[model samples]
Target: MLDSQSILNVLRPVQDPELQKSLVDLNMIRNVTVTDGHVSFTLVLTTPACPLREFIVEDCEKAVKTLPGVESVAVDVTAETPQQRSLPDRQGISGVKNIIAVTSGKGGVGKSTVAVNVAVALAQSGAKVGLIDADIYGPNAPMMLGLSAAQVKVQQSGQSEVLEPAFNFGVRLASMGFLIDPDQPVIWRGPMLNGIIRQFLYQVDWGELDYLIVDMPPGTGDAQLTLAQAVPMSGAVIVTTPQNVALMDARRGLRMFQQMQVPVLGIVENMSYFIPPDMPDKQYDIFGSGGGQRTSEELGLPLLGCIPLEMMLRQGGDRGIPIVVEYPDSASAKALTSIAQQIAARVSVLALA
Candidate 1:
């Protein structure tokens, strides 16, 4: 006879790779049954797109099979979208679970590109996602998401009026670009910048979101610092190119997040290499190579991915459809998707812990 207590004891050694917690300890084992020497149960996961799904399943089965009188093992795996377990609560934007800031040390490194696609990728995986163009001076999220002329609308949520965000590609977007003229420049001082950042968070009707990706302004400045302090950020994703100059600035960005006590999720190396259409067999080092890797090693962080320079990526952003959605099977899209998975995995692990 197979009982629940005996089954749980047998599976006590099985642990989630990311969270490092035993299945029994995490209460992931459910509906345990045994009849005629056959053992079956369900394993609840933190996220449906967990990168280590296979490993966890295999480990659970292996552990259960070790029990005596177990003829066959049947395991069903189910996942509930994990919540932001480790982050502090936001006062105004209390509906948001995870706040991720896609930032860099300097400008012109495809920070907006990375931020937009990552949000799309997470949404593609069946998670509710929102984006904020925190770069008040250069709010390109509206342009990137194909909402250049979109305007903010005021709606009554409960008692007071709230600003509504533009929606496209299944992601909610709010940016200063939609409110101001494209040709006009935002020549504002520091206090104004700070005030608008707060308004975007507190005034906007973001409703509910699993992850809110903030496309932060270039460089570490008052705006960046203010945003970090304003929200309870789950982590920060540092984007950089392989160029030495970009790496220098990227290092600063990584350290800035650490100094603020925000977890640095990982580093993404954009435009690491280029492959021309005419010569598919050969690879060119456009901005040098391994700068992201070197920086990740020095900082002791994970190098989430190395994206190559491709024409589709540039054209997709211009067309207002991110590469991840337009070219889901392309190499660039795959890299972004994998990075998103890693981010989800890290956040789920921390949340569960």
Candidate 2:
């Protein structure tokens, strides 16, 4: 017969694919029993329809079978209730009161950078805001917010409690990167991915704020679906460059939000052109111009603003300070501010109606 303790020790290395933590660490392993070289256990998944059910079951079976004298394994999976899922609940975020998701159809068009600056601009305009870095696979908000090395303090009270968000530049922020090793790759399936997102939304201690900006990963996938289902998003901002390929993806992103019933806030064209500071008259259309504007026109959404390509924008993002904060008077910074103002105005109108 397999010793229970021995079985547990063997399973210690097995981790939840999404949370990137051991089942023991997450308290997901339950009701372990052993008899006549056979083992049975219950695995409490974070969600009922866990997308990784087959993978998890296979992993559990393999882990248990490796135990001395264990011949067979039976794993029963169940999900926790929503209330049971959330730890100690904090006061809901008040004051500035809207949750917006900033997303892109594809990567590398400066989506994360745009998200950070938008949050910063909103904060600078006197609206309290929070930024949730929802891009689990590529969480760059921490680096952009100058908090790559920061950690969120997890509080407990009877049950696991709120995970306090780190603060940078007056905006409260949280990211999966803060909780995981920087170099670790997050390879998770749909269900597990959704659960992690839910955990971030319900378990985090997000205080009063006017807006909670979620930086979504590129592509219209499980992450986007989970976010749309989890939160009543105020609107979505589609970021794209003035290139055809980027615009194509941006259009898909806009359509995704629309299909999910979330309003399309507007489109912002980043790297629209290169303007020399000295010449101030010469404009270089590096990636081709007006793609974003034409897309917005076709979709019947506003073209919020166009951000000129500047070395300062890249420098600021790389240095953990948004261009808006580093050089508020710069053209790119001003453009972002204008975009923020337009969004705020639109949101206000929506609230009134």
Candidate 3:
């Protein structure tokens, strides 16, 4: 029988490609199991999107196989993205591990829909998640989450008053929409916008969270810059439609995040296709096709998932229920869930790194 200690020794020589440190030293080796002559263990990677994942896996397997008594080596690769390294003058969110900004270049591409669904899906998967409607001028999260008439409550915490976030679909949510009357319009200047963004980020009592998804305003504007600079974001996801116009804006959004030193996690093509329930076999390219893929390829980022145009998706949003929760068995729901899984996995891995 090969002892766990012996297996650890074998893996000690295998270093993570990115970190260039022994796996043991990184504390990435998990669930070591030895049965007869076969040895198996899991390698917890820094990011599921790690470009060198294959290299590390192969190296780990080879190292274990070289042991004198080893008959076979089995390695499982898992990832957890590390928390963003704190930036100067910006304190980390209380109990938040990772922050993901969901943005687009132009509006009407269903960016908020994507953000809300992704947050709900992550929560459904047993992870603590928070959602922030950072689009101050056009706050729509309250309506989308079915909390349009809801108001943010205040709680006294010693010397400070914390804003309580609304809850629905298993996600904690903060939005200016909750505070302002639905019929009123916000005509604030840049300074006021910055203050609102800061208050939502720092004043809300978002208890320890696994992920905080920020639904960013459309375009590269002051609000976007304020949010990006105020938080040490783990990464960002660009949402676009399969149309040249949407793609053009999405490219700008991607570049903006990259320039701010925030990693572009991937691109999601919203409204990729439409299929009527009566005619399930035919697919309609309502917004043209391949724009998201082209943007992802041209920019060297991953294409996370393509969400289809469907009535269920719209109805779920209007009813304050995410499609991921309302129609988990539907194709659209599956795509959203898969994308959520990818985001969570990548975020966890990156956070660890």
Candidate 4:
């Protein structure tokens, strides 16, 4: 019999790669229908940015084709991001399912670039994404995300004020840059910084976001501590250039997250190599090579992906555009996009785990 029950029964053997559980049992396969030897169903994934989306779809098709009287398989794909487990001492932002931090050990590792591009990539894949430039003193995300001149709308929600985030490239953004003049410098101490981060977490009108990516300041400091203590995080990603000094700092940052009980998702090696404009065929490891892999191996973490150095990458950031948006086909853009997918995939795994 070519029916919905037969469809589900066939799909029961297809497990989600990351969750390692049967798709039908996980409620990922739904709305099964059959008519005239034709089959159709919805494949609700854990994340829109799932790296194995094509593979999963193909697997489902193969499984259904084996059933009798099946002419074709039509799998409509969608995603429902799962929420991170809550902590007794920490509070979660309403409407935000997962909060992940993108951090580097010391500064100048292009952490903001990685954070902004990753956020945009997730949003590009049909996920509701937000970014918090928690680097209060260096809120470069607004400029990098093409929203430097934009301002956050403040509305009084009862007694306290709730911020309306700026939007661009399908991402919601909150940053000190929106509040300060271009030439202004923030000279606040730990307490002031802590208060503002808390406000960003609880006082922002981030309506129904799948992932909120926090761009943390370099090093293990007050900003990291405040976030760790204040909210339940899905995970944290460490960004570092392929050098000994940067790798040392990355390790320090990773340990801080582990110590604070936040799952360290993975490490991203930025500026792993340089690709000259004229010679796209050649790659030079100006920052040394294989350092990210070695460090990840030593720390027992996955190396998410490595990004190359290109003149256009820096130009895109300075010109208020992310490389992923400006040059999607370039090597650096492709790497960042893959890294973003990897991050989303990891978050899905963590949520299910």
Worst 10 residues of 4 by lDDT: 79-88
Model 4 error, position 79 (Å): 38
Q: How many residue pairs clash in each candidate?
A: 0, 4, 13, 0
lDDT of 4 by residue, 24-104 (tens): 755568789898999999997655887888999999999999997899989999875433323337899989999999998
Query: Could you give candidate 3's per-residue lDDT for residues 1-353 as a string of tens digits?
Result: 47888899888888765434566755678789999888889887545786877888889888888888888888888865433322335567979989899988888788899998898889999999999998877787777778777767999999888899999878899998877765675664346888888888989999999999999888877677677778888899888888887766776676456545577789898889997877766789977889888988887778999998888889988887788888898778888999999898777777677
Local lDDT at 224 for model 2: 80
Q: Which candidate has the highest lDDT of all?
A: 4
lDDT of 2 by residue, 25-52 (tens): 4456777888898888888765678687
- Count residue pairs with overlapping backbones in model 3: 13
Best by TM-score: 4
User: Per-residue alpha-carbon lDDT of model 1 for 159-255, expressed as tens digits?
Assistant: 8678899999889998888767667756753458878888888888888899998899988776666776677778889999998887677766764
Q: Flag the better candidate by lDDT, 1 or 4.
A: 4
Q: Candidates ranked by TM-score, best first?
A: 4, 3, 1, 2
Taking all chains together, each candidate's TM-score versus the true structure is 0.72, 0.71, 0.73, 0.75
Local distance difference test values of all predictions, in order: 0.81, 0.79, 0.81, 0.86
lDDT of 2: 0.79
For candidate 2, the TM-score is 0.71
List the RMSD of every prediction in angstroms.
16.0, 10.5, 15.1, 16.9
